[model samples]
Target: MENNKGKSEWVSQQNYSESQSTPYCITRRYGSLTFEETVQNVKNGIKKLGLDLVGEFDVREYLSSDMEKMPRHLILMVCEKETALKLISNDIQMSVLFPCNVTIKEVENNTIIEVSIEDTDSTWSSAKKKEIIEVAKNTKNILKKLLDTIEQQNVKL
Candidate 1:
């Protein structure tokens, strides 16, 4: 890879100082698909969900990372959810849907400030597929609820 560190001003630099945050902008409410389609599906999902697209990458692009091997590929997006809510409740459970690689990184002003869950793979078996659907549905509901809560908090503030 070319010294993309500061050469391409267009691509934001990755900051290693802060804790990695989950990709909250794109909700799996609709459900999960194979790794091959997750990137495109996430792009479409973010648009449909009315969330902002901070940055996204296909599997090939992510593989270029300095890491020895690219584990899973997950389409990343920016979310205004935490901006509204002080924090995401711990009681809320998150689970994998399909068996594929996925990760979430937070970015600010185009720079990746934090990375989370790098190289996670979910196995997609017949039963796992069904479970993944449910997981995705649950994820959608949680995000919707979180957004609603954020809105309510904003209204109160």
Candidate 2:
């Protein structure tokens, strides 16, 4: 996709068939922010939305420590307590997907935010499917809003 500046945008959308088990992973680029700045903004956004930050993993640091070449990357696991509770109550097996993941990484000169869209196509019951989809949709919206906010703020700089 092309942005207003005619630059190739950094957004991804993947469609999966029933036989494919991969979940959708969406990524958007923030061209005006540094990696550190992007990460901080994401954390602040999560807090502003009243979500719990389970943890952050510094993938790049870990890989680099082993003498591997990798760009700066961080993964944040966040979740809304009430949503998580409702999901678990619907299907305990869904706990494996708890705490959605958001990623920050440096690509070329830009910082990219990545989020895995929850997979609601599991073989669970109808009630469970509906509940899971609802939680997933809410989580996706929250993450997208965070990215949008960062992009807007950076553009004003």
Predicted model with the maximum TM-score = 2
Residue 38 lDDT (model 2): 76
**Predicted candidate 1 versus true structure: per-residue lDDT over 1-157, tens digit per residue:** 4654422322334442323334423222111233334344444544565555665555436544543333344445444344213112221222222112224333343223122322112221223344444544444553444323322222333
Model 2 stretches astray by more than 4 angstroms: 1-23, 109-128, 155-157
Q: What digit string (tens of lDDT, one per residue) describes model 2 on residues 7-107?
A: 22222121212212344555566556777777777888788878889998887676553433366678888878888788888888777776777777655
Candidate 1 ranges beyond 4 A from true positions = 1-32, 57-65, 80-157
What count of clashes does model 2 give? 0
> How accurate locally, in lDDT, is each candidate?
0.35, 0.62
Against the true structure, candidate 2 reaches a TM-score of 0.70
User: What does the lDDT come to for candidate 1?
Assistant: 0.35
Q: How close is candidate 1 to the true structure, as a TM-score?
A: 0.30
Best by lDDT: 2
